[model samples]
Target: MLHPRITRVALGASVCVALAACGGGGGGSSTAVGGNSPPATSNAQITGKAIDGYLSGATVCFDNGQGACDLSQPTTTTDANGNYTLKVSGDATGKQIDVLVTPTTVDRSNPSGAPFTTTFTLSAIVSGATQNVTPLTTMVVAQMNAGKSQDQATQAVQNLVGSSVDPGADYIANGDSNTTGVAADMVGHLEALYGNGPVSWTLVQATMNAYAAVGNVEGVQQSDVNTQLSNMALSQPIAATAALADSLYAVDGDLIQESSTGAVVSPGLSPVRENWTLSGSTLSITQEVQSSGAWSAASPVGSYDGWFSGNFIQNTAGLGAMLMKTDGTWTNWFPNSQLHPAYALSSVGNNLVGTDPNTGDAITASYRTIDVSGQPLSTALQIDYRNPVRGSMSGTFPTGTTAYLASTQHANDQLMLTESGIGTAQSGSWSASYSPGTGVYWSSLSDPTQTLTSVQQVVGTQIQVDGPCLLLHIEAGGVAQIVESGASGCNYANEPISFPVAGSWSVYPRNPNVITISLPKSVGGATVPITDTIKNTINAGGSLVVALVNGVLLSGYMLPASSVSTVQQFPATVTDTIAAAMRAAATNIGETQNP
Candidate 1:
């Protein structure tokens, strides 16, 4: 939740299970949509399961929101096992089916075993093959209702929430709690919000409706709702995963050694072996107790059995969606921060499939291996999480650290020729570096070879190999101190997993225009250091933004530094700082909006 104004409500307070038992469970056949009177195949039925923690005693029906699901339609109540076989016919074959799970359902998944009131979920069937209604599918339905094609809607929701379980299959029945666990959290939160009586019916309905509208109910952002659910994933204790997230976990047998910030001191040791003491947070640190296979699971809260993205694993489900390749290794990391909720994922057919964030076409991570025989071999990381970008990542931020620079936009130039007369007066230190025929040339101080040599046109900031993850915006003629700071718009496709904040980040001082991030990539057995430098002011908000630029990195260190050469100075007088802050807040027109 952006602002966690949570009000914990009591569950199962009354023995009363007066759910929406009022809704009839008798709709019995298939109905065609767009009006095609095709012959019906009476024996043709759709099979699936409904599990908000194995929701039994609930009614499932088929409807297009246009006609009533009476005896002519297919409907059935969930079995004691939460399974349902909606009676269908050939007419339902080509048509899109909105499998509706009415709120009159009760959740046995939560310890409370309460019933949902006034809350119903809808999942759109793209093909008869996908005939299930999970929370992820519910979001897909909302997106579809908002006008996206079912495929588009499904990808959109997957991108946002992360992970792709066969929404059509029952995770519970399949014995996959990694996914079912996430589903339970999703269901549990909705149930908690729905509460147990007539008074909460409207609240529950409004949350679903508002969520469908891509709006918030009860001060919750849709992302917040996702976070609330995922945060619940890490709300429990998983010390091993917890160490990977930010601190160190020294289990009796396993030894993971690291400082407070999530830098992995151990390469690949099951059950970390460190006598760790977290520097800043109150996270539970345990010593290693090494044992081989057959280990029991920690709380799913922040536990992720994947590769590291940053110094921490920002979003477990988000990474789960990547379907990244893993080495049969598994662990979880809990970011002490609440904004970045915890999640987990498992392989789905090993086919890493997802909608391209920009084009919406089926695409896999570009960083994954290419073909040797004109096609990627199964061993080369195809669908089902084979992308290198889909691996687990650790982060390097202090515990209890709240804010970092966020970029809704930025101008990470491929080449620069004195942006907005940045080289106008004195031209500072970089001006002395190199002067070309047309524009000035400055090579990154970190690497003398990679020169900023090109026209000043803004590089597209949309997930290109070397670009800031957030939207990119830069002022045209003037310089500003802080870039927009707060993490919201790192389009869902930033798992390293190409997702945002999932990017490595660290806030050294209060809010400096310069946000230094340590994104460690092991190449040829050594770590590659990539750096990004914004101008001279910290983001207005204390929020951290994960700025990512692919290799041969630029320490834009002193480049943007010149922008503040004449404007902002450290140990700045309080009056000067306030003046600069006011200037930073001032609205400027025509700033570079390099999308």
Candidate 2:
């Protein structure tokens, strides 16, 4: 003869009773009536027991009959005896109902077990208002007979959030509050794994928003939200697990610790230490992991466990659609998305991430992981000087002192030269030297060796250089005090200048005898007499007319003298007579012209 095993399973609100109900009741079973008659009352009680391998926390829900109904969301904690009572109102008449007892604290699908859901078809209620229910046999077990661990569950949550696919309506509807809270906690782990990227503010702000939304329906208080956000700044991963455990025990202790092998799950699901502090939007992590297991002096890692002080609004503006794969390949949904541009990678424990300096939104820190392997070496650098020219100018300046730079688009071996003020011809030579401690180059004016010295520098719009003697043009501002002139004194006169044609002309006064005329494409090779109106005196020099044919400078006598009188020779081609006179006079024409 075989024996029947009878064990007690807790059910109801402090109501534990022994049942002889039958799934396959063999020995000492209660007497049953073998009839198909329906019970009197439509409102009947259906109670059962669920057995599982591990049960740190569990919740039962009634689907189909009561829709998405779970006892956990609507009620408080189950007693220490693991017993719960749900006052469900339903018409129990030939309807199949699913009694789902999901493990609230563990992930079921990770170990590849059949999903835990139990169903029981109820006939008509035939008992009194209250009836004795018995064991409805249904058990949940993991695949490969594996036990679910807290860290595995946490990792699963992280992977889910980090995935591009949506959590699905079922996961969101069922897992919501607890799951999102878990996601917030998992961000810390990601921070540990991947330091804050340039888009950390968007990631963190989205996380905070999701957590807050989850809290709204779960009756989580604003105070709790405040505390959790504050703690996250100190590298504490969000404890959605602990929050679920709220119905169990108070988990207000440490859950994460720095290990040599990298960030590992502590004994429980709380932070390992809370020694970190946040002040004025700055997060300071004083905890050190001395073990080289996870990271060394060369390769350090960080956690997303802390708050990255940054502007969330500006960051969010740059985040359109985002795609993150389980394999950690992430890309923006839109090609135009731009986040906090000033973020850089940093580490916490064994994770690498980036930090954003918040300038628009509230003083807050945002962080994300840095994919270093996918990153390039030379990204971008600040342009020291923009548009350096040969004259006076200014622009968005750098730090330290006002800088004046010679244009980079200059002749080779030339240096940036400048004066205290204009007119006196004060100038100096400049070479490229990096700022002593910054990314600026300090050009030296006195050093002839051209050796550069690092110093904090400012960018100037114009830098001019004077070698030996330079031609000075007197403009509206000041008079030129010609210094160290090697040539004879320059005679200044308001002589009118004229253009023979609309083309470009270069005036090279060879002993003041002639000026060269460069004709435009239209005037080139044309036989028309070139006439010019003199607006100013011709600086005591004669002029020559030269033609450019087919883009080539052709030497010609386009305006030759008439071989008559010197003064009245072919004024029709004004400069032609000048050139012919200079060619004819053995005594240079520069001696005769004084206009």
Candidate 3:
């Protein structure tokens, strides 16, 4: 079991408060009035400026650390030039005290938006002496940049001043003019106070380290001078690996699957599902076969067991491996030990990219972990692309019109074909079996027919035909249900014209043996249904039938299951004879329509 790693990057700015202060104000020499007794009174004048200039009307309060500020005269406001003076008597006199200045409003022009108060300690003084308080503007701006937020930065400044680490007021005051120098100077001040004590890096180093840890060097670089400072302490490999591991664990499971579609491997091939297994440093992968719809278990199609070195996972055998960077991008040539071809990959959040080793084509995919309850059950699979053998035919109908047909067959004994150029588009379906040794083929076509009376009464349309047509219904479970009816063709001026018939079929679960098919005939945007019933045939096998009525016929044969897998192993081919026949019939229809 892998345990999550805790990185030092988790430490926040507030935690730095435990370190010493970074501001000024030290105790002075004391004079004994009566044998080491402190002075009874001390006088000090405090003055400061806002970011723009003088901070007038700002409140300055004195706390002796005992919460004893004269409330009646507890605070004094700065004048127009940001100058303020306070007279200290009582317990505050001759004792080190904290002076807090709360600005009435911050300088809106300052980018940092630091609107909090500034605090500084007043050195113990005798009567008639003055202590210059650092300007609030410089203190606030430096704190804001260090902590990256107004509130946190203000607190940091207070902590610095309270600890007596003097951040040079003059340098801070001119910070906007020479930001680089001022920032460096402020960092030096913080380092002097907290550097050797508990917090090691200066504020500058800590901020840069944080950004660099997350592959955000661009952010640090934008700060200009901090770029050089950050590079000294930047360590992303260790942190990035921990982060990547955490992300991988969140979506890890016993098995994962991804559905993909592209021409990277084969043209017009059906979609495939790729399975993956990730265990510690090892990874295994396999693909589900299209025909069987089952995963191969003998061995993984590929496997790679590696260890993370730097920002990458290199194979222990040193044949090939993958390179992963802190920015969530990767490139690899794993499992293909030859490493003749290379591929690039990126993993951002949930996206994945790669390339095929053999073809050198781009491969894109996405994945999700599968939740398994127990041994998975297998069910009947749907028909899919295997060997598509195309076929076509052309012929003249009794109604004195030409017809054309085109068809293709897939695995699982399924067939689909289309016949166009008739009054309406026509389609055909079949199940088939073929033998290359004897050049013998057997196929079945379903032809369902509608009664002429039902067509006129129920469908509310008139059709011309000499006699009844054989109606074949292909039902669920491969059952062929026949409805004895008449031929279908359009009537024009009492003359028969060949036309295509269209219909839909449905079966009820309660009585699956019975199938009901409906054909709608449209008249002036309104439709009438021609419905019929047929019984399902049971396992009708190995025989071709062509039932003719009024010079129209439907032909084909039932297919066996054993040949399905064999068909999938071969490439698709079209029957030249069948294709020629369909082309000739289409040509006839074109001649008639165009003429």
Candidate 4:
């Protein structure tokens, strides 16, 4: 079915507090922390600087759509260097996070001494402490306001600009002089387009949104805005579809059965949505995720590193330990670390969901830990179990804060067992999932049909599979026939592809519910006498459902080729994720212009 089309993620930086955040463009609101009159000590505070050359003496406050900061909310004025430490009082629910930078006559920049004339609006997706405002982030927020998720919007713009420019980050704090210079130049360029220093954020945002409508940029990287935004005739801004830049070219399925477990990941760490048809018979997992550079952080400014060991998640990147409690609540007690200003977490069902403790946006992190007590690591040998077994884990979380927890799950818990001590690395995914099926052969249960109708009738027939970038035909006594389609676009048909595996298939004598899929092994060109039997495999919908490791981590099902006339039976795209994925695939690779 259809799921939210996603990109890879790393380091999530957020906290869960009671308050929420919004953005604005006026300076009449906040009770300025260090300016105007020192009122009372505020309950909450938000700090930031206006980076249009650092507007000093500028009035900064949470804008309320009313053209000014809400009188009910707090307000402040930037010091000599354009820095404002504002306060939040009362039940800070729905406090306009849209920061408004109103430059009065006295408000001016330092070196250049440029005078402020108009209001600059910016969407402040800020959390606990810092909420820096700039024209670049306004572009990101414009995309967010148009309906794309934060990650999608952030990355889309990043693709538009250079990979080094992050629209959602604080360049000043991150010390990104590269992007900081880009921000400085952006204001002058936008003002040139719209005319004047009193440039409204709306003008800047509309300009960005207009460019985003162009669809794809394939490989258009313009570090300078004048050269980039100048080339295209931007259309009237419209809502952008949520598609990743890489997903447009290819969408292929990979079968990577590893030779060893070098570094520790979840045992069976599959990066796709999986389904289990025959739990104890054979484990099948067909995952459909964006085909990209090994699922890593989508953020240009940061990357993520940690392991799901029992309950605690240790941030190998020095963020320290995040303890996920049994009481359903989570804690980010990184003692003596000022890395993340605000952070909080809690679990909902199998998912660990939370957001900008201040913004209240919902992101996710989830996984299933399989139970393999009575199971064999493979059909070759049975391990005498006395220790804890681990399974593979996968899910989505904010690039800044969300993390996965894997004690176990209710269904589809086919284990991706990680063996250690001796020859313990059988599930590594360092190969490719291309046309030749070079590394490992993968099977799928992508569109399962509870097929157990009659095993005898389906045995000698040709069967086809359609899942991820997977497409193939199953032959009873020969090599498999597979289809040739790229992995990123996922534009394959619903039919048998190609391949020829010469092997004799038969039902297991010991367990009537299982069967032996004697996968052929060739040391050179000659066939070797050995069989790799996957666990818990069975006949469902009259087709063999099996899984592959080292070669792949998918659980595919077989459908007789004759019945493939109905496209829906073996769908080209899952119902839920297709609309979004296809819409994105239609656009070119870049964010500024459609291909």
Candidate 5:
């Protein structure tokens, strides 16, 4: 019967711990004044600065009811000076928490030991806020890896084959007497080839061959071990086959999966198209799929497919099977295969689908009766690829505005757009379904005042909406363009005037609130106070909805639509006041590069 390959993995006992020590959790006062309210169940804050050493972007968690805190909560970034403030909301007042910080990323120079972790207890409770306590020491530092060598390659092969060759106690060369048989032979080979010297690529090949020889050499083996080996041998063939299936069927399953999951992930190589047949003690399998094209591009494509049949060995130790490769070489898919050596039958039978430790591939397999009626059987296989599913669009809308005026369909009842005129604000969202046959997001918001929201489409990053805030989407790539139709903040016809020197340039104000300013002509045109009209909108709370571009200054200001009548022009008094306000809230004019 056509069976899957088996492999095993041995986890090392070494585990590196990370530590984050914080101090200084004493009394502090906010500007606001209020009496202590009733004690409420809540989280507190731990604020401190590291005396020495730097901290990576790691999370600071509290031991809320859970024994250990997870990275699900929002974490603050540490400043350049190593100062940080972590909100420990789940812990109660007076309840001490032994907070330990762990570095999520490994420090290449040191991998064996943990960085550093410190303990701090919540000692006292302040009137209405969380209690504060001071930690013992500072000089927080991460530990370095104390030199220790591990056999990762051998362990990886074992994991892949899901078998245990019983390396015996202290699997050292010519030292341990427990090693013998297949285990001894494989060890001998490794020692002969690697002892007193560096292990070369040849040793890896020899290890693989030893693993692959398992099923062909003995009786039935475990299911888990068999699956791993089988998966490795099948990856390339699966990719080739899936590519072929897409060519013939005109289906791109990768795209379909992406759309469904709302993610742009590379799909695994499974037979996009497969056919199966079963006969006596042997089984045959074949499969194929499409190899190329964007989520929308549907024309050019390719496909591949192959066949194989093998025998199965059934017994208590486990189920074993063998298959002949396309090259006429015999490979055991179950129990053992030279492809993955270290594992044996006992470890191979644990049938579970998992990803490869080296190459993350979602492999699948299940325990099933491949044969019955006291006889053997054979089978064939095929697969087809399809497009990705579309994701749901969602966003937050400013109050007093509705999504009704927008032209887009929401997956549910929620709105995805808003208004652009006075007393209004908006944010928009839409799913990615860019295809030649389908429509793309192309709509405009017109209200004289608010700047058109800019959506950036970079080649590799996710698509994102940029303005006052940024909204990232799953689909990002290809040529990017931003254009506004109808009433806009600026006239595109008049390109941005460049200044030879890095100084200020005078231009007309968009709103009547800014008072005209006087300046001597330095570059470009002569300085003059021009009566300009701004139709921009503002958030109800009084922040500019978007930055205004005038000459070279990226000015910000709060413009109350109520301040001016629709038909009136800017007065001298309004212009002067508005300019001052813009200057007060002024930040950089923004980078010169176009989005």
Candidate 6:
């Protein structure tokens, strides 16, 4: 069984009024009460239409000055046309009061269910005042559905408000109190998610009022509203699951260790990117990680257990280790142990959320389904991840951070570079290509001035990038950082040369600039350091564009398949304009690091 948690927050109110005079005195008016004056008494007629039509025979409860809707206070029932006249007395006369509208037949569909209720805040009532209250009751029936979760109900109400009327203008024209309260609640929720900002009630109310004037001119039908709610409840899981099947997704994010008090115990390393493939009911994830002067690989296998609810997809059980060799050969490292693991995956918008079913450890990550048949080289992409780490607590990963995987790929090959810090430039770059029928290949180039390269080939999880004067140890599903940089003999230039380099690199999807390279510069000597970063822009066709970043740039392109050209480009100066900019900014190279 699937369980969903929903939270209910108070909603703002807006009232529409209509007035009729019959037995009331003609041309008889009551004195307007002042702010500080004692409360005045008045017999007010509150009238409004219901959602579908006039709310006749509906019970209306009004609030006194004490906050709660004091049923003992004056109340009334709407006439056949959904019109109600209330007789106000005591403190309720001069103060804004809350009104709860309840229909006689609560269950519009079931007929036997409990009554449906809707609340709205109305201002001080004067004699002969009429208000349209249809907007308030629009969501009453939806909220009354006992089968839906609170979140779903609230969302339904919000949708109803948006579809039926213009909340901004309606609330403002009716009264400022309703607008203020509603805006407060919405802004509060936003602050909790993306951190606090300059959110104020006054600003919210003004914005809402401005938009509400252009209300829902094309009124929504009750049947359409019900259909939308029903569709959302039943079709979300099926849609999400269909989108996930037989897809290749790229994962990019960070891994960190945080303390119980929500402080960073250790700053996370640079972000990592991995690829996952879901073939039918089985799923396998592969990652290439560089460590020291070598590269390695890892493939964790799992199975899908269909959709749970909302955005979540369940993974029933599966072993979590690679069973195939990097050369497409078979190998069983965990022959004696069950590699099956269970978890849940959910996609919230464009991002992916994964949770540990056993421990309930959840992470909000991001991924993009890869179209293998499409031209990968020309597509601009953006990947986001929310990595939730397990803290010192028993069942919590209090610390979380967002990471991005932005890059352009061609065929089955990719090149990525990123820079971090300031002063002395510390940067790293790597390229990889894979063919399922053949195997996998990779290379790396990490140095400030020297043209040192490393390349390697391996079968299974072990991988390497070996090049002239450079050799890096790496593994699939491992962190990629510049582990070593210097002259290591394979120098094509022959003159011994080396420069220590460090930092991080990554590729973005949406950005035309596919790669980011960051390097650290030494201040004075090597004690104080700063960072210099460069972003390599790409054309719409996914080819690299030579552009300057603080006077530094790196550019690469692909060669035709018929040509005997390798994916290699020696270090070269950019255009004179860019070269001049680099010289001009040379003195300020390590002043500050790129965030």
- lDDT winner: 4
Name the regions of candidate 5 deviating beyond 4 angstroms. 1-44, 47-75, 81-83, 89-285, 291-364, 367-595
Model 2 misplaced stretches (Cα beyond 4 Å): 1-42, 45-275, 278-287, 290-361, 364-595
Candidate 4 accuracy as lDDT = 0.30
TM-score quality measure for candidate 6: 0.24
Q: Which regions of candidate 6 fall more than 4 Å away from where they truly are?
A: 1-45, 49-52, 64-68, 90-103, 106-128, 136-305, 312-595
Q: What are the Cα lDDT values of the candidates?
A: 0.29, 0.21, 0.24, 0.30, 0.21, 0.25
Candidate 4's residue-wise lDDT over 1-595, tens digit each? Answer: 0001101011011100000111112233321111112233244776766654455655566656532455666778777665778887643322335445444423232333343323455444443355555555565555655556657776766654556465546555676655554454334333223222233333344345534442211111111111122121211211111111011111111111122112222233222222211122122222232333123211211111122110111112222322222222223322212222232334433333344332233333233111112111110011101001101101111122211111112121111111110011112232122111222221222112223433222233332222234333344653343333355766434322123334445543322322333322211010111111110011111123332222322222222212100000011232123223322322322222111
Candidate 6 colliding pairs, count:
75
Which model, 3 or 4, shows the larger TM-score? 4
Per-residue C-alpha lDDT of model 3 across residues 185-267, encoded as one tens digit per residue: 23222222222222211222333232222122111111122112222221111221222332221100111121111012222
Q: How do all models score by TM-score? A: 0.32, 0.17, 0.20, 0.29, 0.17, 0.24
Residue 477 in model 4: lDDT = 54
Q: Write down the lDDT that model 1 would get.
A: 0.29
Name the top TM-score candidate. Answer: 1
lDDT of 5 by residue, 1-595 (tens): 1101001111111011112111122112211111123344354655543211223333334323221234555345445533456665553333322233232321121223333211111111222332211111100000000011123332332332245322111222233222212232232222222112122111122223323322121111111111221222211122222222222211111121122112322333211322222222122222223233111221111111111111011010111112222232223222211112111111112232233221122222222111011100000000010001100101211122100000011111110111111111122232221111212211121222334332221112221222322211112322222212223343435322221112111222333212112111111111111100111111111122122221111112232222211001112232232223222222232211110
Query: CA shift at 27, candidate 3, in angstroms?
Result: 13
TM match of model 3 to true structure: 0.20
What is the descending lDDT order?
4, 1, 6, 3, 5, 2
lDDT, model 2, position 407:
8
